[model samples]
Target: LRRKRSSVLRNPPPLTTATILSKTYYNVNSHQPESLDWFNVLVAQTIAQFRSDAQHDDAILRSLNNVLNGPQIPDFLDEIEITEISLGEDFPIFSNCRVIPVEEDGIGGGAGAAMGEGGRLQARMDVDLSDFITLAVETKLILNYPKPRVAILPVALSVSVVRFSGTLSISFIPSSPPTPSPTTLAFSFLDDYRLDLSIRSLVGSRSRLQDVPKIAQLVEQRLHSWFDERCVEPRFQQIVMPSLWPRKKNTRGGDDEDVGHDRR
Candidate 1:
């Protein structure tokens, strides 16, 4: 009796990535969300949390201050001290969505629910982060007209960014067997995100210091690259994919071959 039970257990039902893919998209089509509002809210809250958390982190604050104010002296520039940097209050606003359908071959070609067998979503949004910056700088005196020994001055720099937007492509596939409980879902990013950055500022630390505008431009470029690497890329690769599609245990017993067909 033990031998028979063991044999029965050994030949447990087979499950494959293909099976999971089918069930995942099929269920997604069935349980289609009424609105993408939740996603919008999620993004907004995430940005807010990131800002709040970053502000609280002493290391981050100090590091940023150092970067802006540190003793990196260039030609005609003596020192630049960034006193404050206020991140904008803007949140991610959901603009549009495009639905994609993936086939059993793991190819996404068709559009809308007609190809709901393997449904994917492409969501787009805009992010505006106009950083308000305060700078104190000491410049090299080109002319001999010095009223005081120290030439330190206050500078208000406004890096007014119009927008930074990107499109997020998501693919939902299945996990686990088709049981009484709801089917678990896994997902991946189908495409890369490209963020556009725009900056407008009237920055002049001193009438003689012409490099302040250039410095602002440098800061803008640095910010764009930094966000692309640290924030956007990691958000998709590390956070979104892992959070949505957690690794599941292999439930199969023996042979890769199924005991029976994978019923959709």
Candidate 2:
């Protein structure tokens, strides 16, 4: 009976990163000038959502702290710190995004599961772009650029049977012009630049793996909304600018002469 109860009591496994990646797709035009800003906004929004939702779930916060404090990225461990967190467009850069607990749910759960015991928790995160850039440069994952374009990189999440924790890292690169078109006067746009989102967990813990799918979904939805509101609609209006109207190309002399003779 104990074995059967254990089996029955076990919660459904959380989603995995691979599975989440396969199902999500971004239709935004990443090659455009505004793509970088849009990407940054999306990343910021995602980190904010995670931090906000994680509040009222103490277990998740504790788990997140453990992962941040662990040896996952020893090079960056000292550089990590949390500062003021808020929603909206005031702060454009996120340095070190992390999760922390403010309260406890009576029921026991890790990163992904719904809170138990009817208790709630709260979470907050901080970001400092300069420090993040230093760490990325030291790690050789990024290089110096004249004007770095915004980038969102994935971080690993650590989880166990009773605790969950994780860290988020972001990078930036200089924005570049859209790739040139092959044919004259024919326009082709670039879309769907992949965001490198990675989640890692400690031994014997699978907190983020289970929640990855749902987290991916949430991220996709939020980003899609942000792009549509800020980038897509405005750009669509600008694309039809009067300056880009079709021009009539002059034909050869023979064609003009032939038309004149036919008119006579």
Candidate 3:
């Protein structure tokens, strides 16, 4: 086994001091920072479309169920099931958009403010959503820390988004060569962003418990921890933006049932 492992463990190649590029962009037209007013109009239209779909289709709901029912349920928890989901009837209002230049290593995948040339442009906007988007779940809490199945407690929880107000920043990064990657879009929320949740919990069986304050507290904490770990300030997500190149999916009127719409 050691010999087999060693066979595949050859020495790694040495690193280059600096990456060499195959292409660089130089243009006569200056890269002007956008006001994002028109962009906001476009975004609002897109979100309206999404809400329309949610009202008629369960595709988004299914996706939520799949994501919430994570494969790695904790040992103390039996199964985490999403019993209900509400995408909400209201829309998010985006405003106060402006462009700023920052270094590439700052929060949201960029450095601090840039002085002159060595900086990237990013768009920051304020988003406010005061909708009742929610998810309700059912699960069993297993008391198996010191012993095996000493007792099984049922837990039903529902969390509602009372409000969310945030500063959202979006930045674009071009593909660099040597190993070419697609131009990517990245975005993240600032630390000052706020999220308000209303959580309700029911525990026990035969004689089921309802609205236990501690359970609600714990669930809210866990949800915040989960959100912070992945998307809050200093963290960001980069994804290849969908090709703006016109396609049948963008066709007016429907000959379409496109799972690719799920990409959003």
Candidate 4:
């Protein structure tokens, strides 16, 4: 049960990241009355949809199952039985998300925000919520006997991902020739996270051979490794600008192109 829980939480489906990326874009200068509010609303909407899916999405559950079955482990643990249910309560909730415009000296990544100083904007977002998860598991242990011993346990994991603070950089500059649009900003997550886990009493003699603290340590390591590899480890994500600017018309009677792209 512990191993199964680790598999699901430690290595979540790629779709989860994709979902977040798809929902973070907005145009601030649009004529709509709620243009400025659109970013926050969209972020909230993304969280809500993710929470719902974690609770009841069949496809997501199946994906988790596949991930579990795909891993190769020890012989002591033969068969694994995992529970099917929504991780409803474990979903993240946003407290506040705000975007502030500011001028920065440089923008990281190949993103040409630092080439010339036209304009730069800095944005920040934060999330606060109780991240709780529960799973039921059963495994068969082979003890050199005709009949294998079966062990059952319920696992409860509590991860407090409080205050997810991150910053984004955006830059815009005028161009003389047609170039690719610099209409996107890049951002990444930082290392502010906490997690906890509790395993219910074991039910078989084989349970005595299992070390609970060791399992917990493994979970902790997995969590930290994931953060180091994906979040806190200096990386940037590209976000497209919401508003579209007029493209520079072709002077030689060629196809019109975006002025921003010309500069790049």
Candidate 5:
């Protein structure tokens, strides 16, 4: 039995990066507009859903808060501090995007026992950005007109979760929302550009929480390919000029004047 199980586990089907990449590329390229639209819609929907859901259900809100503010979450939380973002010459976009904490005061108790002996779980989240822009671009020969560039000169997000104890049972009280911070980003021409990105204190829903790590890994891979297809490769081909550029040096000011003076 052990040998049979071991043999089955040993072979355990191959997971080739090429196959995964090909599939991901195909999926991303095939849908084109619909896929891009879905990204926008999904982001909006996620925020809305969390907001609405937390309004009525205290349990969900507490969970969200705990995940955001607690130390148990991912390490990327620290990297999300973005202070400024600039495309070319435009000012920064989006000051900040944040996840507000939910208060749990009078929820049920049977599940409280499972919450372990402690104070209520506390949680919260927030984000800040500097600037934004929109550009027309394409992927796999499919054009995506007016792609939005949401920049954060300095971006930050945070969450905290804590457990509280009552007389009979332990309740979870999510942390209060973190204070909002100011940030800035710049917008320029409707052309190609690279963004300085950051993230902090990201926590997912209960249903998706366990899969967060795996999902994050997959997301990073897909994001790289997606950006490359839509931005990097196109720029490399010189298909479009980036809005931002380095300033030229003023060599004619100091040394050139001295040369002219000496000659005179």
Candidate 6:
């Protein structure tokens, strides 16, 4: 969150025209959503291949571990170690895939957010993943202020994503010169969603408390809150999509790699 805040501060909002809203055209809600059954099948195949690759390699796990350990630890936390990770055995099922009109800001109607004279199209899908995906980590919780390292507790937690059912809405934001950013894909989950988690926790140094009900409850609540703040309902996630146009820097298939001048 600190990193995100700093980045937001560094790169302020781009300048925009005062009459941009007046020039915009909004999507009408009169038309029904268009089905995308064929699209669903193609996406399913891609997910299957991804799961197959995950099973054969620890690359995903290594990357996940690096992400967890890469961030700077706060003064009140230390010695964070990833113990285990399990990528679920089954694939996510995406059904009821359909495209619908949305606001220019990429907010879909299903999210119950306010709309206006804005224009864009968004794809909505029902995603269901029923499998056990778990991550276990051990860290130390340090207590300071009154005195340095007054208390240090070894906290171990294992959280399993038991099941997830949600309505995922995806949309695209057109690239513009003023922003100095690429075309972006934005996605978010509606407020109405079900997420089941199995969490286990142990906290202490020598005499450990295993699966304490209060700790489990707190962790579960925190996880849900964290998720809601980022990518739920009105809040959405955006990914900058790089230009796909072939470029000499990445061109291949010649007598030698990066030899774009040579004909294949």
Superposed model 6: Cα runs more than 4 Å off: 1-62, 103-117, 143-150, 177-182, 205-208, 244-259, 262-264
Q: Each model's TM-score?
A: 0.43, 0.18, 0.68, 0.48, 0.18, 0.65
Best-to-worst order by TM-score is 3, 6, 4, 1, 5, 2
What's the lDDT for candidate 2?
0.31
Consecutive 10-residue window with the lowest summed lDDT within model 1: 238-247
- Mark the regions of model 2 whose C-alpha exceeds 4 Å error after superposition: 1-35, 64-264
In terms of TM-score, the best-performing candidate is 3
lDDT of 2 by residue, 68-184 (tens): 456765342232332212222232342222222222321111222332332222112232231111111101112223444232222332211111122121111111225332112
Kindly report which residue pairs in candidate 1 clash with one another: none
Lowest summed lDDT window (length 10), candidate 6: 108-117
Off by over 4 Å in 1: 1-18, 25-34, 46-60, 66-80, 95-160, 170-220, 227-236, 239-264
For TM-score, candidate 3 versus 4, the one ahead is: 3
Question: All candidates' lDDT scores?
Answer: 0.46, 0.31, 0.71, 0.46, 0.31, 0.73
Higher-ranked by lDDT: 3 or 5: 3
Worst 10 residues of 5 by lDDT: 160-169
C-alpha-based local distance difference test score of model 1: 0.46
On a 0 to 1 TM-score scale, where does candidate 4 land against the true structure?
0.48
10 residues in a row with least lDDT, candidate 3: 15-24
User: What tens-digit string does per-residue lDDT give for candidate 5 at 1-264?
Assistant: 656776666653443434544654533233332223343456656665665665676575345445444676443333222222222222222211211111222222222233343222211111122333221111111123344232212222221111111111112322222422221121111123333322222343334322235434554455456555542421211122222322233225554544333321
How displaced is residue 35 in candidate 2, in Å? 4.9
Per residue, candidate 1 scores C-alpha lDDT tens digits across 1-264 of 656766667663544434654765634344433346676789879978987897777765677667755677443344554544566676655544544443444322222234334434333232233333232333332222354333433344445444544554444423223433322223233335444444333333546433355656776787766665544522333221123222233234666646344433
Error of 6 at 230 (Å): 2.7
| Per-candidate clash tally | 0, 23, 7, 6, 62, 1
Task: TM-score for candidate 6, please give it.
Answer: 0.65
lDDT of 4 by residue, 150-201 (tens): 4433333333332233332233433323455535546555445443444342
